[model samples]
Target: MSGYLALLGSSFEFFCLVILDLERFALAGQPHWDELEATLQRLENDPDRGFHDLAAAQRFHYLYQRAASDLGRLASFSAETSLRRRLEGLVARAYAELHSAREARDTRWRPLVWLLETFPRTFRRHAGAWWLAVAVTLLGSVVGAFLVAADPEAKASLLPFGHGEMNPSERVAKEEAGRSKGLANRRSSFAAELMANNIRVSLKAVAFGLTWGIGTLAILFYNGVILGGVMLDYLRAGEGLFLAGWILPHGSTEIPAIVLGGQAGLMLARGVIGWGARVPLGRRLRAIAPDVATIIGGLALLLVWAGIVESFLSQYHEPVLPYWLKITFGVANLAILGAWLFLCGRGPTPED
Candidate 1:
């Protein structure tokens, strides 16, 4: 009789365990069912929305994964046919939606779309930092230029490669000869070298932010001084027009890229400094990662375009194209870039 009683007690406990498992499964799936249904409804109502919106897409993905996990759990333990069926259907729908979105993003034009829509929007969010970088560089250039203009002796310290040692006429002659040789004889090699050097400089500026942005600032200041000194020397030599023609075409793009790189570095530095300390240092750095990537990507594209222009159109074409024409080309390029940055991807404002 005791043995019979023990078997009965064990069976009862097993039944209770099964009942508890069923309850847990139902509770787990209930919330996910409601959310999945709502999200599906929203997606169906607005087919054009959600997929491109990063937040919405992430939410949908999260909900989908939850629903899928619930489906698996219910299939394994739940005897309720209706509950399992409902969850299975929801999972199927979500899988389809996610797959479709993924396919759409796989299109070739998706990268261009990202560049046009995402890059600028991200950059605009950090416009203050970018503008600060531009201001610092411009101020440095002005100070350097003024110093060179005020004191001839300052040229030796500011100018690279002892350019200060050359007399005005000698400097002018050397500049003209270098330009002629590069353009007339070694245009391809010159362009390649210039592009490589410019890219290296921009990358250095961005990487130097690891030093808390001091390295970045120093690079900008040093380059600014070199530019100012060279400009002054050319102007004094009465070759101002020549300088303008030679520099503007590539400088318009190259300089802006460098500034953008500096801006990225500053953004990184801000993350490192933890100005408010509201978030942990690691979190702050992670937050700025996307912005840094966008800025660097944009800078790289600009550099490639600048390199092409510098090599093919800016350097050797001076003999074929008048200086005014080259200047006009530079202006046109700048205008297009400005419009793209400021205006492109900004659709019509919704009616308030």
Candidate 2:
């Protein structure tokens, strides 16, 4: 008995189904069958023409269920072989259309949505790990700052790119005097090098989770030490403006990207440790793998942008680009990145 329509309570469309014989039932269902078939044909012919509205998609699912019910009923009528076969085929096609793996992918994967929404949501979901990374880096910075303040000569070993032996004030003077032309003819190549190097470093931060996070923590701490040493050195030289201008443009994004990698690494280590979790180690690792991958992917994009800025903009000094203006740009960039991470995806849309 296809009496489910009784819920409609005398609706004109379903009224005939309440007490119809086989022939009458066939007559009534024929129109709906034709409609479902036509919709399916349209979908097959124009694969990209997905349902445009919730109502239409709902109708399609309802039609599928109805066709399936009709096929089941036809199974009892031995003389209705032709009708049964036709309906079975239609029901099968409708089922495939609704559940096809390709359609499932199309429905779930939206790149822009993932970028602006899903990535932020995922990062927020695992923000504890990221904050932990920040804290570790901060601790390392403290240690590095202490060492630099105590021993001025430590800068040689504490700094890189030949910043050790030279005074920060002298470097700033030279750069402002237009001696920063080191990459003038090779800006593109330098930018590419920065991108590749930074991405590799970030990936290493993530990959180090295989060591149960020890290596990841070390990498993060070392980075913090470098930053702290540089900051203390420049500020000591009364080059605070130069430091802010030089670091902020790229560091605004680059530092966070690296920290994000550390976050992913910590997350992986958490899975490996599974301290409070009751699941099997393998299952735990598998569960967190996607989150790790997503964070890494987002950070890679951030690093690319940071690398470009570092080479093309961050390298230019005071007279060419005012320190105040550069510092303002960096502050703005930092604020934007912070807002995007903290607020972008916290709307009505489902987070997962």
Candidate 3:
């Protein structure tokens, strides 16, 4: 009986010792775990840095082994289940890093090549979609102009954003007489707002392709109608030169940007339709995926430039900046943009 009682006491003592040991080990290893986490984070954050430091590699390996050992020791105890799980995760991550045998290909970003070559080439490849967008817009414009010209009352319904309320000639006179100063202190804010509004419109044009391009067509047509109505209004008011100087400076870029967005939408629609293509839906989409991204990139660049031009140059009417000068700038800008899109990427590159 005494031997049995002594054995029970010794078992209780062993239990107490295990609990104490668990507490001590957990406390001691926390710092190592933290160090390992920090090291892993550094490696993950900078792929370019790579595993160049031998000391770090050795320390990482050692920490992983220690965590694994701790995990094994904790297996018999249920009280430290959470710690065991954490250690397991850390050990697994470390193992992956240590055992990775494949050398990853280094890919660096080259913005210039993408901008100068890729963007325009993708645009040219999808020119059919752009032309279709242009045709739909032109049709709408013609319809809008005819409606407004036949019935002056139609301007109120067709023209939006209070444009129909203002007489174009009066507005031009006010702008030339220094109402243009309204944007002086607020040019940057105005520019930012313009960019946001135009970019949002462009993105919607791209997103609407999900409707098999009906939505995209509607957006393009509506924009064109609005543009045509406004142009006709200014011309009727005998403010044609002012209209040209005002709209052309930014419209040269902004209009094309919207059209390109429609182009992207049409491309997405084509991928969805897979009309003549026998490939699977996934493959068709995959083929045009890069092209869609390329078009979006171009649209963004064009809109940003347009926003700057509208805010900085377009608003400065005749007195602040000559009408003739603005007209010339607009013409030159359009010509240069046309050449960049159509001619720049046509032939073989010097590298070829």
Q: Cα lDDT of all candidates, in order?
A: 0.77, 0.87, 0.85
- Checking candidate 2 for backbone clashes, the offending pairs are none
TM-score of 1: 0.66
What order do you get sorting by lDDT, best first? 2, 3, 1
Please give, for residues 236-257, the per-residue lDDT of candidate 2 as tens digits: 9999988999999999999999
Q: Which sections of candidate 3 miss by over 4 Å?
A: 1-107, 179-181, 349-352
Candidate 1: stretches off by over 4 Å: 1-109, 161-180, 183-185, 348-352
Q: lDDT tens string, model 3, 267-288?
A: 9899988989999989898888
- The CA lDDT at 5 in model 1 is 94
TM-score of each: 0.66, 0.71, 0.70
Model 1, position 146: C-alpha lDDT score:
91
Instruction: Give candidate 1's total backbone clashes.
Output: 0
Worst 10 residues of 3 by lDDT: 100-109
Task: Answer with 1 or 3, whichever has the higher lDDT.
Answer: 3
